[model samples]
Target: MTTSFETLYQNLQAAVDDELQTLLCHHQPRLLWESMAYSVLGGGKRLRPLLCLLACEAVSGKWQPALPAAQAVELIHAYSLIHDDLPALDNDDWRRGKPANHKEYGEDIAILAGDALQTLAFQLLSDPAIRRPDVQVRWVAELAGAAGPMGMCAGQVLDLHAADSVWKEAEILDVYRRKTGALIRAAVRMGALAGGAGPEQLQALTGYAEDLGLAFQIVDDLLDLTGSFEALGKTPGKDLMQDKKTYPALLGQAEARQKVESCLLRARDVLFSVPLLQTGHLLQIAEKLVHRET
Candidate 1:
């Protein structure tokens, strides 16, 4: 019998957790490690890492080799959240239902923790353990491209600019594509590359990531509008409070959900064409992304 998606996800999450623990186990400076451990270990869906592992398994038929890449992407995500929550940015006081990293650890430690996780992600990727030197370098570039100026950071700048400003749909979507979609796109491509995917397969996976990423962000906007803090592990209504650009703000709740459904269909179509035995997990995830309460 085929394993269920939930079971597969639980197993993958466990592996990623183990890998993260091993990577940070022996680090020096108790405060830094403490902050790192607190932020990194803080619980969430692990969606990005799971995407990497699933894409790897879909192409290569195993998730083990992709663990390092999965861990790297997750660390980048954690670091981003840390920095995003600081007084300089979103100024959120809670995450995963606990005090935000900056609130609990102080701004200096929070900043250093984010920096450490970002650098450590590269350090982990550069290790010979995951892939060959050439392949490792390629993976690093992929991640950097997604997380750096042209990708997530660019989106963040646009978001900041959008505050107290009227935004066009194109502008909002551009932010979505760069900020959230970039890293997700990297996750899929990194997995495919690690699994020896050719150009055609890579292109297909990229298309899937694009749709999935947009849908994911749209749902996030919806959640911020409709979901409870307990469910989201962060403040709700912040988008409206800050006048942030978002799908629901521009498209309305009903239209935003419709857009997510359309994206989900596109994602499902691309993912199903890949001819992987493990495609169900992705399809199910797409469904969840559109339908999830949080």
Candidate 2:
């Protein structure tokens, strides 16, 4: 039988897919448009954008107004992935079952593409048609915090340093939270702020995002162990090869799964304090994330 989480995930996925298509079609550049489109439109779970939309809905804001922000979050995510696949980083040869951006387009173009996408995210946030200047500034700051030295970038540095070293579970969580969870949390906060959430509401959603983000990383770790390339759409077992710390490495597989479940439950509990009707989709997403195969 299909679970409620699966049903909600499909609905959110459809919405995110449509939004991404519309945004990509509308935005064009003089050069490397094709590469930019390929990077942005590549197949992956639209988790960041979905979080934006859900956070908007959770705070009684019109979700439509946050679509641009959602697109911006996704652009940032795409940029990170593009850079992550570079030879200097993960050295990945494939992504989503296709040649890596650097491999397909050449490293120079791939780097430029990522740079352009990162800038484009700010442009999207600043578009006068989409958001007020104040909101734009706030959202841009949030994005910068999540993507720059103090956030995802820092996490990546930690990840590189930890390679071939034994790391405690806390250290692993610290790295994942910064590298992965920071942007995820930013996505949620940006959506909530755009949706007119007050400080209190934002606080609750922040907690929810934290739990959800950690659970996401844990699930990713689990998939690396249990999934195949066909199902994962990327190389599995790469973490093990790299000797990177992961939830499953620190905690046993069974314990890691339990941790994910616990995190999802905590996320749900936090969301439950809000009006159930307002947070239904967000709650559904937290549950669905834990159980996703890819």
Candidate 3:
């Protein structure tokens, strides 16, 4: 029997592929479209969209209604990765076993592609297909807050600054909360709201998402220490070389693993308290995140 996470992952990938292909079908400058497709279609786990779909289902909302929003989340995620891999940023040469966007495409095209994807996210959200105008507006606002200077961008800035300084664990946690946790938390909350969750349920699910996000980052840090480039689909040990603070760097490998476990436990506990049936899939996602090889 297929596990719930496996099934959900397949479904999420299908949805993402469909949405992305539709976006790519439009006639545009070939170079721009190809660059956009390269960054977006480069294999990814599609975790953000999965969270959106599951969160919607958890609230008894139809998953179809949340598809646009899910696609929006994914676009935003792809845009972030494209920018993150830029020479000015992480300077990564590989993503999902392929050359990073800027490495394959010119740096200018890659930057433009990232910008286009970011704008497309909002365009997707604003489409009439997504029901509830108020919900869509709120979702856009939330996503903006998470992706902008006050959130992930700010976290990246802090990371760059911390490259030359000794950062405490708390400071590192703050950076991850913004860089990684913000989008993740937004994905969950947006899913819940799209599914028409009550305020209380949303609150509980947010807690679950937040814990899971932290655990995900902790595991990512651990993987960087031990995983091979082939298994990781990106450069490992980059964080250490960059002098960026990570959970493993601050807490030691064993302690970092323990922290991931603790966070996953807390996420599961939060799920248990919620009445949403989709919590089963959320728990599975949390497990997969910690155990993922790539």
The residue-by-residue lDDT of candidate 1 on 101-203, one tens digit each, is 9988899999999999999999989997654887788889999999999999999989988976788888899999999999999998888877778777788
List the candidate 1 regions with Cα displacement exceeding 4 Å. Answer: 1-3
Ranking by lDDT: 1, 3, 2
Candidate 3 per-residue lDDT, tens place, 1-294, comes to 147558767977898788888887646688998989887876888888888888888887467767787888888999999999998989899998889999998899999999999999999898877558999998999899989998899988998788678888899999989999999999988988888898889999999989988988888888888989989989999988888889898879999888889998998898878677566777787888877866
Once model 3 is optimally superposed onto the true structure by TM-score, how far is the C-alpha of residue 231 displaced, in angstroms?
0.8
Candidate 1 residue-wise lDDT at 213? 94
Query: Which parts of model 2 are misplaced by more than 4 Å?
Result: 1-15, 25-31, 275-277
TM-score between model 1 and native: 0.96
RMSD to true structure for each model, in Å: 1.6, 2.2, 1.4
**Model 3 segments more than 4 A misplaced:** 1-5
lDDT of each: 0.88, 0.85, 0.86
User: Per-residue lDDT of 1-294 in model 2, one digit per residue for the tens?
Assistant: 247657766777787778767766644553465677788888888889889988987786467767788889999999999999998988889899999888888898899989988998998898888637877898999999999999999999999878767788999999989999999999999999888888778888999999989999999999999999999888999999888888898889999989898988888888876652377778777766778998
C-alpha TM-score for every candidate = 0.96, 0.93, 0.96
Provide the clash count, candidate 2: 0
Q: Which is the better candidate, 2 or 3, if ranked by TM-score? A: 3
